[model samples]
Target: MAPGEKLDPLPDPFILQPPAFHPVVPYVTTIFGGLRAGKMVLLQGEVPLDARRFQVDFQCGCSQHPRPDIAFHFNPRFHTTKPHVICNTLRGGRWQAETRWPRLALQRGAGFLTLFLFGDEDVKVSVNGKHFLHFRYRLPLSRVDTLGISGDVSVKAVAFLNSNPFVEGGSEYPAGHPFLSESPWLEAPCSRALPRGLWPGQTITVRGLVLPEPKDFTLSLRDEAAHVPVTLRASFADRTLAWVSPWGRRQLILAPFLFYPQRFFEVLLLCQEGGLQLALNGQGVGATSLGQQALERLRELRISGSVRLYCVHC
Candidate 1:
C-alpha cells in the first residue's frame, strides 16, 4: 500500500426525515409542507405517573387570540375508572359532536409509541406499531398544519415519516418498482425540504464520501424561522463528531471519528424521546439532546463542507 494514498469516496444512506427528541409537554409546532396521504406522524413518550388526561390536536395554526381551528382533537381521559378516548374537532372556536372510543391504548407511567398514518379519507392510528383505530377527518387534512400535545405526558420524540415515497411529492419514480427506486446522487452543499417536518421515531440517513483532503462537513435540520433543531458536524482534522443542539451548544464526541479521507460512510440519525441517536456504518456512535425547539418546524436539511454526497433519503 502507498504511504500517502487515499481511498475512494462512499455512498449515502436513506434518511427518515428529521425528528424531535424529548420535547416538552404541551408542545406545539408548525407542520411544514402540510399533511397528505402516505405520510405518518409518530409520537413516543410516557404518560405521567399521576396523570389524569391528555390531548393531541391538529390545528390550522397556533393562534390564541381568535383560537385557531382544530381539524382533529384527540383527547384521552383517565378521569373515569374506565379510561377512554374522545375524538372531536373545533371550527370557528366551537366544539363539534365528539366520537368516543371506549378503549384506552396507553397506561400510566409507561412508555408508548403512537403513530398517525394519513390517508385520502381518514387517519389510521396505531399504538406500539399495531393498528388501534381510524378517525375520519372532519376538516380537510391540508388545513391542519400545526400539531399540539398537552397534559399528563412526558414526550420523548416526534417524527414525521413517509410510508409511500413514490406517491409523495409527485415523484417521477415508477410505482411498479417502489423498492428499486433510489434518488439520484445529489451534489454537496445542498439543501432538501422535509415536507412534513420531524417527529419522534423518525430516522434520517446520510451517506457520502469524505474528500481526499477533508476538513469538516455538516448536516443541519432547520425550520422556516431559521431555528435549527439538530446539526451533525464531522471534523476530519480533529477526528471528532460534534452534535450541535438547537441552542447552538456543541457536544463534541472524540472517541471515534467514522469519516476517513475518500471513504464512503453511512450515518444514521434516529429520533427518539430522549434525543437523537447516531450510528456510523451500522455501529452505534452516541446521542445528543435537543432544546425546547419544535422539531416539526425543522423542514429543511442542509449539507455542506468537505464531503461529497452520494444521495439523501427522507
Candidate 2:
C-alpha cells in the first residue's frame, strides 16, 4: 500500500446460506441438526434505545397447549434500575429457580454480537466478544431442538454454526451444512474479487486455523489500481500484529499473540463511516481510519500467509 494512497475498504463477499438478516421480532426457528457440543448460535443486532428487555430461549418444540419445555432461558433485563441477566429452565410449564448475573455489558442503542456456545454440560454465553456467563444444563441439551427469541429487541442476523471454529477436526458437521459444505475450505494465498466494494455497516468474517510452525499471515484490501490500501499482518514469531503501508509498518505486541499456531480464529471486519473495526474471536482488537473516497476504492480481498482458511463471509 502506498504511504499516502489511502487504505481501501473491503467489499461484501458472496456467501452461501448467509445468516437470517433482519428477522421479525419474536422469531423462532428449528435448531438444524439439533444442539450438540461445539456448536454455536450467533446473534448480531442492536439494542434499541427504548428497549426494556429481551429473552432467548431454547425449546423442545413449538407446542402451545402443552407448552413446549424450555431447556434454557437467557433473559437480559434492562428495564430494572440495576440491569442484570436472568437464566432459568422451564419444565412441565413451570419455571425453575432463576440464576441472576448482576452485570450488564450491553449498551442501549448500540450494535452487539452475542454467542451461545454449546458444550457438554453447559452453554457458554458471550456478549460482543467477551465471555459473560455459563448456564448449566438443567434439561438435557439433547432435548433442545428449537430456538426462540422475543421481547423488545431488533435482530439483524441469526446464525447457526455446526462446529467449533477453534478446534482442529472438532465436531463433524452434517453434509450440506451451509457454513461448511457450501463455503468449503480454500487453499492458502487465496484471493477473491469484491465487486460491490465495502459500504458502511457491512461486515466481513474470516474463519481459519493457523498452521503449526507458522511465520505470519496477511489480509489485505486492494483497490482497482492494484494498490493495497489496507493490510494487516499477524506474526506468530514476533508475537505482534502490524499495519503495513508504503510509509512504514506499525506493530503492536500482544502479550500472547492470538494468532498462535494450531489455533482456530474468527476475524470480523466491520466497515464504518470513516473507519474499520476489527475483532478476533468476537473481541474488539483494532481499527483504522480512512477517507470516504478511499473506502470506496476497495475492490479485492487477498488472504495470504500461514493459515488454512475454512471460510470467508464478506
Candidate 3:
C-alpha cells in the first residue's frame, strides 16, 4: 500500500469459488454453499419421492450476522412442474411471502429467475431475459438480509450485483398490433353485413372500410332494446386498442395524425349471456355486459353514431 495511491475495485466478496469436491451429489447433497455473494443448490434426483421433499436453504451475509434471504421448496406428488417465484418481506418482526407467476407462464417450458434488490420499490422477475413483474412495495430494507437461490433442478447460472430491476412487455400482443396501425378509426358507411340474430357465445368479426379521414373511431355493439352499447376503440398513441363497456358515456382522445386510411381493419367481439367480449384479432382486449335487459331482443346490432377513440373492453 502507498500513500495517495487509488485502490482498485475489490473483487466481489460473495463470488462463488471453485469447489474442492463435487459440490453436489445425487439425492443426498441437497445443500451447496461457498460463494462470496450467495449460494445455489438443487434438489430432487432420480429417487422416487414426493416433490415437496425438495428444499432450498439460503444464508445471507456472514456466519456471525447471517440473514435468511430466501428459501424455496416444492412437491411433485400433488402439483405439476411449473416455474414460479416466491417473494417475502419482513414486517413488524414477521416474514410475509408473496407468490407471483408471469402471464407467459401459461405457456409451456418457461423458466424464470427471481431478483432481490436493496432500495428497490418493486421486485423485478424475468423469464427468458424478458422482464415480467414490477411488484411495488414487496421487499423493504429491514427485511432484505442476504440474497440466495435454490430449486429442484440445476440452475444454468447464478450471479448477483447491485442493480435495479424492471419489467418488460411480453409476447402477449403482436408487435404489429401496436406498430402497424396508428390512429385507427372506423370508416363511414359502416354496416353490419351479418344479420342480427341470437349470437349467444359467438364471436363476430367486424370488417369495415376506412375512409381518408385518418381519424380513430369506435366500433360499438348497441342493444337498442336495452340502451346498452359496448364499444371497442383503437388508437395509434400506444399502438393498441381497448374495449369500453356501456358504463355511461366515456371519452378517449387519439393521436392527431392518421396512420392507415381506406384500409380494412378487423376486431372480434365475443357473444356472452349478458355482454360481449372484445378482442383485437385473437388477443383478449376487454368486455361489456348487457345489464338487466336481455340482449337477445336487440333490433339493431349496428355501430352507434356516437364514436370516440377510447373504449375499455369489459
Output the number of the TM-score-best candidate: 2
**lDDT values, one for every candidate:** 0.72, 0.74, 0.36
Query: Which regions of candidate 1 deviate over 4 angstroms?
Result: 1-17, 165-314
The alpha-carbon lDDT assigned to residue 298 of candidate 1 equals 70
Q: Lowest-scoring 10 consecutive residues by lDDT in candidate 2?
A: 8-17
- Residue range 105-215, candidate 3, lDDT tens digits: 212232333332222343334333344454455433333333332333333323323220111222121111111112344323244433354367555544333455544
lDDT computed for candidate 2: 0.74
Model 2 bad stretches (over 4 Å): 1-18, 165-314
Model 3, runs deviating above 4 Å = 1-187, 193-197, 208-213, 225-228, 235-240, 245-264, 291-293, 303-314
TM-score of each: 0.52, 0.53, 0.30
Arrange candidates, best lDDT first. 2, 1, 3
| Total residue pair clashes for candidate 1 | 14
Clashes of each: 14, 4, 18
Query: How far is each candidate from the true structure, as Cα RMSD in Å?
Result: 17.9, 15.0, 18.7
* Preferred candidate (lDDT higher): 1 or 3: 1
